[model samples]
Target chain A: MAYWLQQILNALQLSSIYALIALGYTMVYGIINLINFAHGDVFMVGSFCCFMAAAFLGLSFLPALLLSMIGSAFLGVAIERLAYKPLRQAPRVSAIITALGVGIFIENFTLSLAPYPKVIPPLLKNITWALGGVTFSSLQLIIILLSIGLMFFLDYIVYRTPVGMAMRAISWDKTYVPLMGVPVDFIISITFALGAGLAGAAGTMYGLAYPVIDPYMGIMVGWKAFIAAVVGGIGNIRGAVIGSFILGTVEIMVVAFFPSTYRDFVAFTLLLLLIIIRPYGILGKPRTQKV
Target chain B: MNMHRDILLEVRDLQVSYGHIKAVKGVSFTVRRGEIVTLIGANGAGKSSILKAISGLIPYTGHILFNNQDLQKIPAHKIVDLGISQVPEGRGIFGNLTVQENLRLAAWQRGDKQEIATDYDRVYTTFPQLKERCHQLGETLSGGEQQMLAVGRALMSRAKLVLLDEPSMGLSPLLVREIFKVIAEINLNGATILLVEQNANMALRLASRAYVLETGSVIMSGGGKLLSDPRVRAAYLGA
Candidate 1:
């Protein structure tokens, strides 16, 4: 029973991280209609940024986290301006290819800087609480709380703010939004920045929980989070969170009960089945074009 | 009024093509201040193409001058900042955003938040349905309400000129009448309007001057009353 409780706790921690990163993918896709393939590498960069700030600059954990978020946001804005903006008028396939190329570039760049995985020094690794025979670390608590907080903040910004409205408008019809005097590019850039910032925070928390960092770390986790986004219904924040938890719990439970090697296949099979059943995912509404 | 003498928008020999097919060819017209200038045409008559070109959505070869400034050199967003707002065809409101958010996004380029707030109140007063569904997502609004939100959004920009593309499309007959009434009211309140419509009768009724387009070219041009002439009635109005 304790082992089962531990697995649940682990699943929750993993889900929180996936939920945070998946929000970025979902939000960007919602607004721009482009799957930011490089989003995963942004997570990798965020972890590395945190590593550099903490290990090299000798900054505290909090400051390092902030620095990582800022650095990732800057990178997000630059990537959007340099790589994605030019492809705005191009076909969707071209943009998708460009996103893949960007992902490769970021991964290669990080590998050149730090070729091998490094263990993140354990600062908050000590167990902070025990509930129902399950131990919870401070890192786990922080990850869950921060993820929830960021998700709520993002929901507020997207639903309650003017910029959020512009983002939604552009998502529906790009040409009309700009004619209303809203600078569409600026709003799009800001959306990229916000999504990247959330991913960075997720990265920081992920490093703290697992205490491992590598250039390729973002690929697998990024793909899983993206899967979570699709599972929950891409472009819906609530869906992303719900999807993350479902994916995380399912993966953990499968690993516990079945062969660990089958986990990846199971997760992907679920994604494929869900897509076939409902292409819009769980939370996405079907959009009908006017004649 | 006499303010129609002040030309606000001038398009000279504008040509737009989609690869091998030309959508708008050598179309030219002028919209005067405080007058409703209507462009009437069939589905393939290039009325929308002209509006798209004027707003810089589609690349075109032509001279579009607003207040004597060349519009061809500027981007679409800058065109909005230059005080021209378009309520696109099918009432292109952001389906996921609320009525208030839709209005707020329209005034994004403006810095006076206070005045923008006042404008919000003004829009709500003009479209009470929008006020009642202020918190509801745009997609949930009825077709007529969406059209009102689209116009309300354009008004929030505080534009000197408003371009309406098929505002009465996909609406009930009663709703169509209400939309036309709002368009005239908006024009009377000191905003130049360029209305594009397939409904020649309604367009002519609301506009001071009218242009008839056919297959990417202007077929006729005259006072709005002339659109009801025997020849025009037979050709376009199906008399």
Candidate 2:
């Protein structure tokens, strides 16, 4: 029982990171119907932001997190405006190719700057608590709580606020929203900013937990989170979190119960089976009428 | 020239193209304050395109003056702040959003926080059905209810001029009369109207004046008597 509990705790930490990153995919997909293949690299950039703030500027965890979020937000808005905006009216394949290209550019750009993978300096105290033979670290607790908190905050912004209303409105029908006094382009930019900011937060927490990050790291983690988002229902907010947890728990359990090398292989296979069963995903409704 | 009314919106030599196919070619018209002006025509006649231009939804080369201010280079959202609201064709309601959110969206650019509540109340009073389904998702509402919600949005936005595109489309005959009555009520409440409709008979009955558009140009325009004009009857009224 304690062993299961320990794995569950581990799953919570890992899933929270996936959840944060997954939201960026879901949100950008929600508004523009673009996968933003470069999103993984945005997560990569976010970690570098955190790395710079922590290692060079000597900022603590909170400041580093805030700075990383802001940096990623700006980077996200810039990416959307410069690269994605022109392709808004272009073919979907063009945008997808551009996104893949953008990801490659970001990876190469970072690779040229820093060829080696960097280790994150410990910004938080390493404290451990063992409850009934289940051991957990403070870093795990912080990552889990902070990530879930951020997701809820994102939920509030997407559902409760006026800007959030516009965001939802745009997803439903981009054409007529402006007639109701909505600045469609501006709302889209805000969506990108929010999505990227969350990814940045995920990157920062991810670095703190894993302690190592390279330019190429976003690819694998990003693909997994993208799968989580798809499994949860790509455009649905709550779905992404649920999918992330499922993916995280499954990945952790596979490593625990089976060969550690089969972690990703098993995870992908299970998600594939789930997708075949529920094509729209766990919470996603079939898109009967796409605007 | 001998009238007290001022033109609320003036379109001069407006042109809109959807890649070589000129949807609206050199269209010109004027909507004086407090008149229910209907633009009646068949599909592809540029009626909707004119509204799109005035609302800044599409790019155009001609001048559109709203309250003597040129609408050139203005964006769509800004056009709403200029006090013109369009209930677009297909009732452009965000189906996933709640009825309350749909109505609130109309008040997006308004600064009068106090008056906004009054507007909501007025809309609720006008369409009690909307109030009952305020918490429901917009897509769940019946067609008439959705039309009511769309028209109700005009009231919520505090628009001075309302551009209605094909409001009567896909509605039952009974609901059509009901919507037309509500539209008349909306106009009597003081918003100027530029109505575009394929249902010429219904639109003509409700409009104070009318323009006949054919192949992207105003072929003919006149007072209520145009409803019975021999040419209009043969071509449009289908008598």
Give per-candidate clash totals.
0, 0
Candidate 2 clashing pairs, residues 3+ apart or interchain: none
Over 4 Å off in model 1, which ranges?
A1-5, A123-127, A255-262, A269-273, B1-5
**Candidate 2 positional error at A44, Å:** 1.5
Q: For candidate 2, write residues B138-177 as lDDT tens digits.
A: 9898988999999999888889999999999999999999
Compared with the true structure, what per-residue lDDT tens digits does model 2 show for residues A210-244? 88889999999999999999999998889999999
True contacts kept of 1: 0.85
What is each candidate's DockQ, to 2 decimals? Answer: 0.71, 0.78
Candidate 2, A94: how far from true, in Å?
Answer: 0.7
Best by the TM-score measure: 2
> Distance (Å) between predicted and true CA of B69, model 1?
1.5
- Please list, in the order the candidates appear, how each scores on TM-score for chain B only: 0.96, 0.96
Error of 2 at A267 (Å): 0.5
lDDT of 2 at A263: 96
Native-to-model Cα distance after best TM-score fit, residue A57 in candidate 1, in Å: 0.3
